[model samples]
Target: MNQFTHINASGEANMVDVSAKAETVREARAEAFVHMAAETLELIVSGQHHKGDVFATARIAGIQAAKKTWDLIPLCHPCYFEVEVQLEAIPAENKVRIESCCKLAGKTGVEMEALTAASVAALTIYDMCKAVQKDMVISQVRLLEKTGGKSGHFKVEA
Candidate 1:
């Protein structure tokens, strides 16, 4: 059976010790989707929403969330990283697609940071547009790619 990295021999949860690990350039990319009604999508794409610049708000939220991931998640090490978040209003799909990337030179990977960024960005969109549409659904949050660290490189298969 595979052992859990956050568990100890005593079956207690604990943060992994990465002090001995070598620091390297690590990067991770993650994605999320927020599905909504056609009218809601139209409001976002047409830039007529009263809330003002949904994409810009979401982008800032994602970047802030990435930097604070260590504080939000238990057992995660504090890391300094650069983050980029992009959100697109896809009217054809009636949804907003969010992609986030986090990069850092550190002992641990930045996958969690990237994932958190994407998730928060999606949530921010929902919060901003709830007055216009309350039934929005956030889904398909996943890590799309990762590079560096001991794991080397990984990318989702098309």
Candidate 2:
């Protein structure tokens, strides 16, 4: 594993200094899964979520979350990014998968933003459906891959 850039030698939290790092096109993808009752999944697929359009709202919310990731996570650099998020309902099952891709040409990579987007999207799904299925759960928010940076590309163990 790479050295912990967000931690100091003293084992205290610290932000990485990227002023000397070169800027490049960096990108990352994240995924999240939400499981619920089979009937809830059908309602979402049928556009009957009552929250209007759950998938569409969640997609927009995820993009906004990526743009504001720095504000939410201390030590992360503020980033200008291009993000795309999709929420897909799994037919014949009680799950929805949220995928987010983020890109930036900057000294820091956008892994945090990607992960934040997917995480929030999954949460949004749960929020919209909770009234009906209080047991809906959001889980597995993770970075699937990252590319372009001094540390190089990564495909999470998969």
Please list the Cα RMSD from the true structure of every candidate, rounded to 1 decimal place. Answer: 0.9, 1.2
List, residue by residue over 1-158, the lDDT tens digit for candidate 1. Answer: 75799999999999999999999999999999999999988888888889998999999999999999999999899999899999988888899999999999999999999999999999999999999999999999999999999879999999
Which 10-residue window in model 1 sums to the lowest lDDT? Answer: 1-10
Best by lDDT: 1
In model 2, where is the ten-residue run with the lowest total lDDT? 86-95
Runs with alpha carbons beyond 4 Å of true place in candidate 1 = none
- Cα deviation of 65 in candidate 1 (Å)? 0.6
Tell me the tens digit of each residue's lDDT in model 2 across 65-156: 99999999999999798999988888766799999999989999999999999998988888888888999888888889999999789998
